[model samples]
Target chain A: MNNKYNIFLLATIFTLCIFVLQSVEAESESVYEIRNNQIMEPLVEGLPDPMNGREIVISRIGNCLACHKISSIDESFQGNIGPSLDGVGERYKEGELRLRLVNPYYLNPESLMPSFFQNKNLVRVEKKYSGKTILTARQIEDVISWLLTLK
Target chain B: MKFFLSLLLFSLINSVAGRTENIKGINDNLYDRPYSIGELKSGRNFLQKETLEMELDDFDNPGMIWVERGKELFNSVLEKNNLSCNQCHNTNKNSLIGAPSNFPKLNKDNISLINMEQQINICIVDYMEARPYPLESRELLSLSAYIAYKSKGLPMDIKIDSSNEKFFKRGKELYFERIGQMNLACNQCHNHLEGKYLRAEQISQGHINGYPSYMMRWGVVASVHRRFQFCNEQARAEPLEIGHPDYNALQLYIAWRGSGLLFESPSIRR
Candidate 1:
């Protein structure tokens, strides 16, 4: 019975290691593909939540308000660095918006906007944040969904 | 091969076009100020009314405590060399009045830059034969505060001559180069959006004239380098350690940018 218990424990540990490795691989995997100036695929499985996107835009993780102004948001002291996001929903299609969020540099090399979903090619990132994208794929989708409602 | 050659030619033209656009207002002269005269504003002008009042009233200002400590340190004799800062610097021929505004000056090596804090350390280690104070230490802050206090009301006079031109150029580049997850450059907020609100606080024209100012958040007398580290962290960038060469170079550039602003060390800042 003791020998059987030992085999059972070994099997459980092996299963746990596999689960952890798979999760890490999922995190490192690129979620969206860029085609020219657009990304014609969704980044994650679930439907995007506009409400969650709004919170991220205002919060520090997204910090969109630090440079961009959103008219629908009631927060005071919104920045004016970027153009107002009032009619951004009407301005571009879903794929174009996805490309801009993933990598604004594709359109304008000198654009001051940070690539929220791209981790490579960044310089001087804080150590704790070196390998991390500013936002997760789901978070980027959420932000885009909320931005789409600005019209 | 034809496609490759055409691609290279197109990139060459694009690169040339990009540089001309960026170099619009900048001049070849290192002495040329980024902002024209009369356009510059001291960081003091951005302070809230209550904080401004506190700065104006010496009795109410908490930074005075550090300045007072600095004065004591400046006058105290070192056992190692039987000397004090006041003995050499306060002499009739070498009085340090108006001296604070002239750093980060060229060091004795004449290649690298050294700020008021580093200068103080040099004096202790080289002249007074004493162990140098650690960077951002209370004693070091106090000494710098005392020296800067002597230069109060004098307009800053940073020199960007042949001796320190390279450092000044590096500093200017640093001020404009975007960094971190935020991809923010110093010129974006401080230069373009001065007096604009980020959240609630008004963005000041980034100036070092009021450092080593008393910071309300930390409740301590902070050095300019310490403040730079905080700004880096706020932009989600990695902060270099205190007294890093890059920080000194950035300091030199910022001091030059605000060259005419009056020095106000240990000034109250929130």
Candidate 2:
């Protein structure tokens, strides 16, 4: 009985370790895609990228919720500064979004929307995050993928 | 074993029930009062019920940690003037009632608008004959929290006379001016949709009575200017330094907007 219990305990520990490791991998894994037409190429990891995009829509990461409202996220609070993104898919082409995602300033110099992928020309980035893009290329693509499904 | 499990379950139920009862009691009068311009509800009122409880519990309130640190620093002697804050001001906090609310007004000299943190540094430089504490220094923040802590519950009484009129006007412009790559003005989030939520966080009027308040996200207390810098940065504008004149002017304006709200110094925020 004691030996059986020891085996059971070892199995549980191994399973727990794997579960934690997988979550960490899920959080950090993103592939950089080389896009021909985007204003700036995004880090594109094709691995279940849509879920990543949905999170970015709702999260402080993309801060999309700060300006645009998305309907399905089940989060009760959303802002109205930008247009509601419920039908964003029907409105703009993927190429247009790619431009906006990379840097909205290219399309409209006066636009207040932040560049999700570009880093170099940003103003007032905190010192520790100076060179960092708000969202990785993969993250931008994930957000775009999710935004596309909104229509 | 069965008895222990049952007791544990019973206690948990009782505690949860007790907490809800306490919340009901507290929430009853928080935002039910008459509203007026410059007479807005507190950020505390907008807090989620659970967070409000965390702030109300003095022993459990995280901001009290900063207040305690400030208290300690208040009694400690300065290296330059051999004078501690308690040497001049009342060591007993109650004596400072209604004092901090009068700030961001003209100083005795009527030269520049000064907030609580600036007043602390001004005292250090003018009276202690010591160098002003560097802006946003932990020592300075602690003292500011302590002094302002004394004035908790005092209605804001900032004066907007000739001495501070220009600063107040400039600060008002800054509040409404759109900046940052995000092109957000302070009024867009705070004035327009204060009840609305952003990223699940409720928008408050962006008042500053709570500084050097503790932010759970930062896990540290921050000065008012630090919060301003964070807001500017989030708006994608270049955040000015902690003591920039623009931020100071903004602070003055915000303080005036929260004119009648009781102080909640070292208040907790998400």
Candidate 3:
């Protein structure tokens, strides 16, 4: 009788431990997981490498380098406008960086940075640039990938 | 332990729901009205005409007063510098169109440029060997107003190249970003509520055209930078100092944003 009671108590404790562990994992996964109702889409694949990403950043086509600074290149360029991006990779994970590149204001709604992937239907702009994404999904992914390389 | 855990989870969910509800409330209160570009353009035209007529109504236009003071300062040759503004640019006022508009322009001598206000202060400190007037002081306001008055009606043409792209982008970011205890973005008010009203007065696009305007509220002329500082304060956000590079970038963006609107310096505003 004593042995049976001990076994029963051990089984209950084990089940409870498993439940708690699973809940914690789920909570963490939710942070990185792309939800259906989210304003912006998550990066899936087909992202460009860091070098090409750098090209896109510096180009008027991307314009990320316009306000931010990355120490990888020593081109005679420096802007006092935005924060330096020397070790952004170390500061944030790939998923967080992806979210920021897509729309920095999502995390900090007060961010001056424009939402790169904001749906056009929601955003109002001049007729000429209306209904256009500021950056393509692929470009956004590439930028995120590049940002992750700052470490 | 289980009860405590359940309580923690419940509180977390409640807090998150509360935050979402608050955000929704703010969003609903913000930008409840639509804005039209055509109406904005018309308003700009009306204000410009009214300002031009105002020049005739009062001999004591603040802009004119500043211009007269600037004229005196320009002509007065100091002991250290034998040169006066007359020595370089001559006394022809007509030749000075759009000159002040182009400033905070690049100065060729220092390989670094300064704004009109900075230039005046530099002259006072270095050339005239006089004590530099504090920024926002009557002396500085008068000089900037005088310069802006001279450059009135000239379309603003600030350049943004690779060199300045960073600054431009920063300015753009700042403009759109939300700030303050109210968590209101500039676009939330200026862009979204362009024609709406917080009170009796219409919120006119918050355009920068009539900057350095004579505010009826203040009963004094205020610079664009000063106005920005005021807005920040009103929003309950920390205001950046005048002549700060971030503010300069913001100034550049505001000027560019109000590109279509005609210049109306020293104009009266409520």
Query: Which 10-residue span in candidate 3 chain B carries the lowest summed lDDT?
Result: B24-33
Deviation in angstroms for B64 in model 3? 3.1
For lDDT, candidate 1 versus 2, the one ahead is 1
Q: Cα lDDT of all candidates, in order? A: 0.81, 0.70, 0.60
Q: Encode model 3's per-residue lDDT on B149-220: one tens digit a residue.
A: 766777666666666566656666677655543334566566644444332344556766666677657877
Candidate with top lDDT is 1
Instruction: Give the RMSD in angstroms, all C-alphas superposed, for model 1.
Output: 6.1
Candidate order by decreasing DockQ: 1, 2, 3
Say which candidate scores most in TM-score.
1
For residues A87-109, what per-residue lDDT tens digits would candidate 3 score against the true structure? Answer: 98898776667666654544654
User: Candidate 2, residues A25-81: lDDT per residue as tens digits?
Assistant: 434432122234343434444553788888877877787887678787777767765
lDDT of 1 at B183: 67
Q: Candidate 3 docking: what grade?
A: incorrect
Candidate 2 chain B — worst ten consecutive residues by lDDT sum? B24-33
What would the TM-scores of all predictions be? 0.84, 0.64, 0.52
Ranking by TM-score: 1, 2, 3
